[model samples]
Target: MKHYTSLLFISSLLFCWMFISCKSTQRLTDWSLVWEENFNQKKGFNEQVWSKIPRGGADWDNYMTDFDSCYAMRKGKLVLRGIVNHTQLNDTAPYLTGGVYSKGKKVFSDGRIEIRVKLDPAKGAWPAIWMLAENADWPVGGEIDIMERLNHDSIVYQTVHSYYTYTLGLREYPKSGSKGMIDPDCYNVFAVEMYPDSLSFYINNIHTFTYPRIQTIEKGQYPFNQPFYLLIDMQLGGSWVGTVDPKELPVEMKVDWVRFYQQKSIK
Candidate 1:
């Protein structure tokens, strides 16, 4: 009887230890909220966190930049309106759309980024919340797309494009793309938790995908260690989105909030 009781006590102690161990691991990541934006301002978009300029680097897009009426803040929500206008951007695009990037304003190396948003349910309304390297050039600098829904897609794509993944095609084995089902009319939390070696994507707090570091691959393939800035936009009539419906003009991409957190355990 004593042997049996000792065994039971030992087992109970072991189980308790394991439980505490798991909880400690979760507690290790003491995340500190670094920056956040709720878009609750009554008048205009915050210029300190975002820039109104539409970068000319998207050579594949067939649209121009417009700052006058393309974006607005209504009822504490930031709206990125995509419209068909006669606005000419170097005679290349006649449609006026809105995009905001945090190039020189704010950037982070390793942290957690979350954006709560809802896309307008209109065809050719391509909305995305993503990040790109601030220092390096296109593809080579690394692009981490937390959520990109195009052409009224019911699914959101989470992808990473880097020189190692795209230019050299080193990411051919594990397949560096993932998607999650989402509703266009409702607000969903799209997030990316960037670690030292990997990027984990989440939608509405559910884990959707993970882009792990290729330790065996070349170092050039991993460009996520550097500081990356955020970009939120509603791109209209791009090559990927096809033609727009004039009747669906003035599609609004509403953003409720955005947050950034830097982990203290990442030393």
Candidate 2:
């Protein structure tokens, strides 16, 4: 009888340890890489992995601008340089800028996504790395903003928009006063872990926020179950970041790498 009791206790302890380890591994930073853009070397963008959206004043997320010079390279890095010009109304001329998306090429369903990037501190420069649902219209398919920074404010925002609700909302991480100018020179990592019932965000391996299942739509309406593509861009100005400073000529957002990971399912 004692032998059997000892065996049962041992089993319980093993089970508990396994459970705790699993919970820890589920953390946003703990996921292992399934896909990655290291941008280790090379020059120019990888056409197979990215698609440029071209220059247009479409007011995406209240941003105003016709076009900007945006570039991507096979080395895995993406660069967006802002130019200032006095030629045309939307012609923030001399500036090289624009945005890129993994629209037709890549999309993810449920996994961990991470991007390592640097932002340009110039006023009116807005940079973001985010995701969009694969469906035909937006907000209807859902939008997940993993990282977005307003240059003037020196603050970053993470947000989600879903058709299940009609409200616009966001969670923010503002830079401390002592941090000084938030610019492209200082690199940062932004990441998200997506699960069936929840999603979480992390900055440089530090867990910052979590959105629970209660805030999501029902299973049938969950647009996140389908594949979603990634986007990286820099906007000149608009409602959020305000207008670009006429004096601040060329500004750029530099990206080091973009990576994706998935946890192994328990069989």
Candidate 3:
């Protein structure tokens, strides 16, 4: 009987050790820093780390523009500003400036992504910090929006798009009253925690939404497991942002930083 009791005790101790170790390993908050860009001193986008969206109207979804350098650095911040100019395509009015991107450079997968950004409060500014799969297709591999703003309100959106479906999750804080605004500059830290089984969105340190992994990714399609490049742009007057107010021209989206973290491996 003593021999059996000793064996049981040893088994229980082993199980307890394993449980504690797993609990520690599963803690997402204890992530290790894998990559980050503070954007503190650089005057322009790093060519080695980022590629510019070439000057052209074909790349833009539907917005019209006569591309002339739309991005600049001012007072230690990366600023995307819109410019309006006349174009031969439309003689009735002047062409408005816009931006769209992600061609080459840094890309990755299966990690936490964060961006610190302040957006323009103008009526037609649509600014976004997002990611697209390395695969040469649209929504086939996947798309993850770390932060997106529509000038209609102070609210911001974080979303994930797959070939199967698109999900837009929202979190808003008013500038005053019971729902006080999270920040004064209309800016906040936005982050997305991407895991094998789920995705979580965080705004200004507050957890807002969690999406469970979809099983059977449909037609054997699971593209999110691959690396994706980041895209940051300030589009003017799109379906989401609507028509621009001429008085609101030359609006800017300020980016403080972009960071990435990865959970440590259990093994």
Candidate 4:
């Protein structure tokens, strides 16, 4: 019975991979790849394109650690590790995790962004591929979440936050029908196409959510005009994601690639 169950699980994963891989190419054929991080090297990433957080930066109840060991590269992909009480580092957090950002080098304007990732659904895992404004203050600068999942659940959350969404109490949750369900155990594509007028989110190239420009609200939600940088993180546990189970130690978020593209202009 166990062997048969294993085969079934493998078949499901293969099906998911086939569906996701084909959809990514179909959706992005119109745009040309401008910048991409394939995570090719085994040791250290391209310092010019990506940067890591050496120490966990946390002022709230969430755990953040600066230990570099929480990250690694395997099979030509970047792996973000989350572990319990990473005692090897001087970080004071109860848990140690990994985070990386494309802040200075890879900030981009309105375009297409795609990330291929595989997540472990162990309890207490909060993995996300998101973006933040290059300038402005918190809650006012704007945040675009391409994908975020909590506690190994199947739902993928895509949200936009700004002064308007904050005052409206819609930061933590979406404005309804703005989420999709996905299989985290297999590689899936999460994408966002940011236009001057609106933003669209997708899972495996399937349109799942959309956020339009709220013009009537003034600067309440208009902070998304400038460039934004990408951030990929594997958070251990927090207020919204709850607590991490110590037994589910050494969980990881595997990222195959992050590619950015721009639509070619016609002559």
Candidate 5:
């Protein structure tokens, strides 16, 4: 009788645990799909939603170009490439990379966004899918790096940077971000759920980490509650990722699709 009672108690506890686990994951399913992209057209991305990222002096965008060789739509995917300057005889930059941003056309707050991509690893390749505040300057407003894969890393980094983290350097307490292992050769889903109080990151639907808003008087500690725009780029030879290996030129990042969802209660 004692053994039977013990078994019954254990069964009851297991059932409760499974129920709670399902409820927790059901919170994410409660979101309603608001926007999505499949990249079905061949004339590059929808201009109404995305604009070619302009060249900048910064390493990330220094090689950004709208050259034909840098962008393509193949097999229903958006392909952004980083290639050695073999064409554009007039251009002087040794490398040219493809990038796009949705600043004015699409901006959202307090929502979940997911991107499915396949990263091609190369010695100097640095591909990223990230977001920045639409109306505020960088580091001041905040930067949310959903995914950043450097070189041939088997894991992708998901990070958040703000004045607190970058200027004041207060990242140790809250731990701004984390890394997740990924299959370098296959498509992986990188996502983030941005709320007014915290940001939850996930890789392939598995929760990785969460950066929560902490009680502090510091500026930019949690500036992610505002609307932000997206930036997807195929970068090469950045200071963080080191110098480019010419032999590894023509690397690419294939984006299968992107989707944005908001809490069902939002509207």
Candidate 6:
């Protein structure tokens, strides 16, 4: 009888220790919210944090515009629209899109960035949430594409670009990125957790893939450890996404919120 009682007490103690260990592990991995934008203001996007992405010669932003009709704030959401250019007869582009960047206003590093958004499908709609280095130029600096949806795709692309991947064409060597399934009709959460050694991508809280820094003589194998600014845009008629159908013009992408988080255990 004494032997039986001793065994029960030992088992109970072991169970308690295991429970505490599990909780501690979870706590260490948990995140503490650092900054967030809910777009709850009655006016447009907070100018203190965002600015209209300038029109560039690239196919992606050639039609980028500062038109009032392409941007709106409704019911705590930032709405970016891509519309046919009937009203803007003076503007040569056939379409105008709305986009904003935190280039000079806000920047972050070594943390997780998440965006909750819903996209409306158009024949040539391309909406993206991405990050770019604050000071460095293209390919060499690095590009982190948290989420990019082309047309009516049910899956979004999460990718990273660097000199190694683009210039040297070493895309598959270190696994540059991945694509994850998403719901076309409803809002989905897309996130990228940036660490000094790796960038982890997730969709709807499901782990999609991780791109790690490996030992290499390549000059720009991992340039993502530096500060980066965020960009969210509603783009249309890109060569990769094909031609726009005027019948489906005026499509929009609704952004519910954006958040940045750091590990709770970190300072």
Q: Highest lDDT: which candidate?
A: 5
**Tens-digit per-residue lDDT, 1-267, candidate 2:** 999999999999899868755754566344567888765556656668877765554544333233433454424566666666544565444444567788989888688888888777777787778888766477777777888787655557776666553333322211111112233457777888888876777766556677655543333234566688998887777776677785875777778888888886655
Q: Model 1, range 102-147, lDDT digits (tens) per residue?
A: 8899897788898989887677777888899999997888999998
Deviating ranges (above 4 Å) for candidate 5: 1-28
Whichever of 1 and 5 has more lDDT, that candidate is 5
As for TM-score, the candidate ahead, 4 or 5, is: 5
Misplaced by over 4 Å in model 4 are 1-26, 54-62, 168-177
Q: For model 6, what is the C-alpha lDDT against the true structure?
A: 0.92
Which 10-residue window of candidate 4 scores lowest in summed lDDT? 53-62
Instruction: Write the residue-wise lDDT of candidate 3 on 102-188 in tens digits.
Output: 456678678888787787777776777777877757666767777777765667777666655532211121100011133527667
RMSD of 5: 7.0
Per-model root-mean-square deviation over C-alphas: 9.7, 11.7, 13.9, 4.1, 7.0, 9.2
Task: Give the poorly placed runs of model 6, Cα more than 4 Å off.
Answer: 1-29
Tell how far residue 96 is off in model 4, in angstroms.
0.1
Candidate 4 lands at a TM-score of 0.85
Q: Estimate each model's TM-score.
A: 0.82, 0.72, 0.72, 0.85, 0.89, 0.89
Segments of candidate 1 deviating more than 4 angstroms: 1-30, 55-62, 86-92, 217-219, 264-267
Model 3: worst 10 consecutive residues (lDDT sum): 171-180
| Shift of residue 226 alpha carbon in model 5, Å | 0.4
Residue 80, model 5: Cα distance from true site in angstroms: 0.2
lDDT of 4 at 137: 76
Per-residue lDDT of candidate 6, residues 185-251 (tens digit): 9999899999999999988777899999999887799999999999999999877899999899899
Q: Which lDDT tens digits does candidate 5 get at residues 112-220?
A: 9999999999999999999999999989999999999999999999999999999999997699989999988899989999999999999877789999999988777
Tell me model 2's lDDT, rounded to 2 decimals: 0.66
Clashes of each: 0, 13, 0, 6, 0, 0
What 10-residue stretch in candidate 5 is worst by lDDT?
20-29
